[model samples]
Target: MSSLFKEVDYLRIPYADIKAATNNFDIVNMIGIYHSKNVNYYVYEGELFRSGKRINIIVERILGIQEVQLLEGVSVISRFKHNNIPTFVGFCYDKYLGGYLVSECEFMESLEQILNITPNPSIRKSEYRIRENLTCYHMLQICLGVARALSHIHDCHAIHGSFNSYKIFLDKDFEAKVVGLFENPEYFPLTRYTCYVDPESECLNIFLTPKSDVYSFGVVLIDVFCQQHAADQSWHYLEFPEIPEIEYTHFDDNIRKQMNSKARPFC
Candidate 1:
């Protein structure tokens, strides 16, 4: 594993340090879990000490990741420095336990958790919840933040292959921080959130492109504006060859009532 990342300039965290930080993978520290390629990845909020300074971080324990894939992900993430993107600190690899990607945890919760959206009921429930209702202003801010992040990556000639609401994190101020990049296309079939996926890419079995990210972002836009799960609206578009038209009626009832007459047309 060391040889695989020899040329990469990233911290190679010791497995022991990761175990210590995450309290031996205790459930109390675990904050989130998501699946990829039929394997479960656990996200834990932990504190790590580096040069006598403690850093709050998110440690994602990824099971069933190949060494080459880990190396590629690390390489891609290390090049990113956008504010809307998580700061990749390093990685930990264990011969028996698999790989771990570490990043700075500046966010309060994932967008999915804050919005109370669940793609799969069988997945672990989120313990975090925000009492405040999502307003149009907040939704626009999140949309722009994510758009900037996507634009940054696209400018760098990279595609966020697994862009989705679950991959979006929100800080205390609701600033978006996008993660979960460099994902393998082979894992697409295993993902449960088909609504956010590009239908063309799925039908053609082609590699994901920047257009795919845009398609997913549109789905997220619908999710925020409608306060409805993307899956619920996906069935309506399955018969259409192009992206389905999102009508004014699709907006959340509260949002529609809140909108001024002039704003309705713009929206």
Candidate 2:
């Protein structure tokens, strides 16, 4: 009940088909900003000609000799099916188009937006508290949703690679979905602004491990718990100014153990 109502439906689309559907890559229908210059992808909002259903799709153009390489590599991503993962409708590879990865886009906004978008009030304002509507319960549900998604992804023998607040998306109901799976390591260093990156991975120079994901998830939990007050600081630098005593005592022992006074997040 905490998740979205939409069900994932996958479609295998040809290069020509997508070209026609998007009217030779019309820029007007594009939905959101590109994730990053380094990520090499864009999300376009387009209508399927056959069904006329509006779709938010992730498109990646494979460059040069990498076209053939990407076509082979993306086959697995196209088949990914999980509640927390974005649905892969289809993809296309052609001499003109290179290669593209299209997925069902469910993002409303990043968790980072939720934490950072609203300006911090100089004085405690009731409107800010009342308007920003997420409660502790909602926060817990978000954490559970992410954990379930991560567990399912790991069960499929893949690590999210980039797990953090910026990579998490929320639906209208505030249900969380993870993005940035099958990440390119080249963009890893650029994500150092967030403290969710695994210290072990940074120290060892290894890539993609379940342990790293868990560590990142722990950092995300801390961020979620801090709510709108979450500054873009590293986990070690986080400051929780206030803790509701009654609500804090209400959380179970397991949750309490993980969120002790020092704010050490453990998987």
Candidate 3:
């Protein structure tokens, strides 16, 4: 990981550049917010006009250790070039308020929002085309896109510390793009929409591994197929663990078990 950072080439943007682009982080231009009381990083969405072209960007206001760590992580993450993964833009460091890590803004709705039928599209056009529910074809496309993104990241010897429905975005065309790749593990938030967390991660003794990613992938697949939130079902695994390993052979069984009986007709 250390070697990966040494070779990373990044676009260093000035604080004034970002401020001007976002209108001093004005409320009117603010399109979204991602923050928590415990975390110092506050993410905001705004349109950036660069070279006379309007570009959507997500800016993360970073302070203290987050600034150093995230900047280093972003160095490597920005090098990624994949259709299924979100592209990294640049970063800005300020003398007073700290720095900002910027990435290409996802204009689409999150998988969670889509599943819950409460999508908040960035524009009016996307809202009109967004579906209330995902079809089998849509689900398959999502799974394949996520799988390819994960494979590419793993091939690069990096882990997508944060992988969940909220981190997966679907454009108006329903093409999937996995976000939050190479995010700090400590700052990652917990979600109830999907239990796409590795069971081993709960144990202090066990460090995160690629197999952990495989486990989370299984959970995500189950959630997508069933169109169900895994938060309630996650407790069952804690109460009694049974599955030795998740494999392609177990796909049908897992989907069938998790799917609501009412959805049987559709299946």
Candidate 4:
């Protein structure tokens, strides 16, 4: 009876309404950051309206597995409703445009900032371009949310396939949102980052199971733990010396690569 509370919470947002929020989809008002292949941005408003709403959009390749990701991934992630997970808007295609994914726009930097924000005097802290807080609680929430999300997908027999810290976007309130929801029965990359991936999953096959995602979560757990100790904790690692190295041999090889190359996210 008490367990039911976890599964019942969900947001009921219509796809068309999200479209309308973006001003019939205009590039001018799109608040997005540019990448090599695709573009991820938020829709604020355009010439179409006097005032507008902000939304999230992903412009990915029209071909290759990415196309499948947009179609199947959105359908998969969109199935489960969770606050930590970003709300999926839907997919759009037209003759002029290859494809576009519409969803809730979350405006926040990333956990990547932890390196600078949290100084690791042990690792010899260096100045960074940006500043942000990466509290221990924040790290815990990331794990909890990702775990819950994976559990939700596994219930449907769907695997995340691709998982990484970069793929996890942080919202304004510092909530973690894992990207790449669709399923790819065809192919999944073996290594996204040399250090973040699991050593075993690094073989040749794409991990199509919830346990695999859990393994990836472990890698994240390790990274955050390291950061917490080095910076937030007593600068002890500095004197302790000999901080063992970490190796994520199994992180997705293609999530970030294809996402930037063939995916060619045009901002």
The most accurate candidate by lDDT is: 1
- TM-score of candidate 4 to 2 decimals: 0.53
| TM-score for candidate 1, residues paired by index | 0.80
Tens-digit lDDT track of model 4 for 145-250: 7777767767766766655554555565657765554464344454232333444565544554566677767766655545422112222224332323454333
- How well is each residue in 150-242 modelled by candidate 2, as lDDT tens digits? 887677666666567766766667788776535333322323223455656655556647777897887677667654333333233234212
Ranking by lDDT: 1, 3, 2, 4
TM-score of 2: 0.58
**RMSD to the hidden true structure, all candidates:** 5.2, 11.3, 7.3, 14.9
- TM-score list, all predictions: 0.80, 0.58, 0.66, 0.53
Q: Which candidate has the highest TM-score of all?
A: 1
Local distance difference test values of all predictions, in order: 0.71, 0.53, 0.59, 0.46
lDDT of 4: 0.46
Clash counts for the predictions, in order? 0, 0, 0, 21
Tens digits of per-residue lDDT for model 3, 147-237: 9988887787777754666567666677887766364334333321224557556444355566667777777776676555544433433
Clashing pairs in 1: none
Better of 1 and 2 by lDDT: 1
**Better candidate by TM-score, 2 or 4:** 2
Give the residue spans of candidate 2 off by over 4 A: 1-37, 40-46, 50-73, 92-100, 105-107, 117-131, 183-194, 228-267
> Of 2 and 3, which scores higher on lDDT?
3
